[model samples]
Target: MIGAAWRRTLNDDRSYHAINLNEFSFTVPIYAYQVEGEGGLSLIWSRPNRD
Candidate 1:
């Protein structure tokens, strides 16, 4: 499981904030999507335990 937070500032003195959460198995591929006029998203994965 993973969590994230986001914030954006516009040139007109406007701002926006958002939050997201993600869950996936260690053996599966992850995917993400962003809608038009919405903010962006970032995905990060860590290597599984080797032991």
Candidate 2:
């Protein structure tokens, strides 16, 4: 699904020039913190790997 979206973006009509993203990988920052909830403080952390 991600690959299909990437292909669509590359072929989008809004883009005038070609876009080539080869051998690329993207990583979002892992945040670890706490949030105050109605039941007091709650834990917040990075999402575990899904695959």
Candidate 3:
């Protein structure tokens, strides 16, 4: 999900969001709709343990 869920939250057209997930210490940098484009999501950073 991106850009305020594209549904409108708190009646605000624009809002700031951050993604922080800790399992593999995964985190994503701030991204806007302009970057997401049609995909609606951008992978800024990722870590995977294939082993």
Best by TM-score: 1
lDDT of 3 at 29: 33
lDDT of each: 0.47, 0.37, 0.39
**Can you tell me which runs of candidate 1 are displaced by over 4 Å?**
25-51
What would the TM-score be for candidate 2 when compared with the true structure?
0.29
Worst 10 residues of 1 by lDDT: 28-37
For candidate 1, what is the lDDT? 0.47
Model 2 lDDT per residue over 1-51, tens place: 112112122244532222222223524333344444479765455634636
In model 1, the Cα lDDT at residue 45 comes to 35
Expressed as tens digits, the lDDT of each residue in 3-51 for candidate 3 is 2323323354553234434433334333333224366755454444545
- Per-residue lDDT tens digits for candidate 1, residues 1-51, read 475656656687665544455556434333333323445544343444435
Tell me which of candidates 1 and 2 scores higher on lDDT. Answer: 1
Displacement of residue 6 (Cα, Å) in model 1 is: 1.9
Comparing candidate 1 with candidate 3, which one achieves the higher lDDT?
1
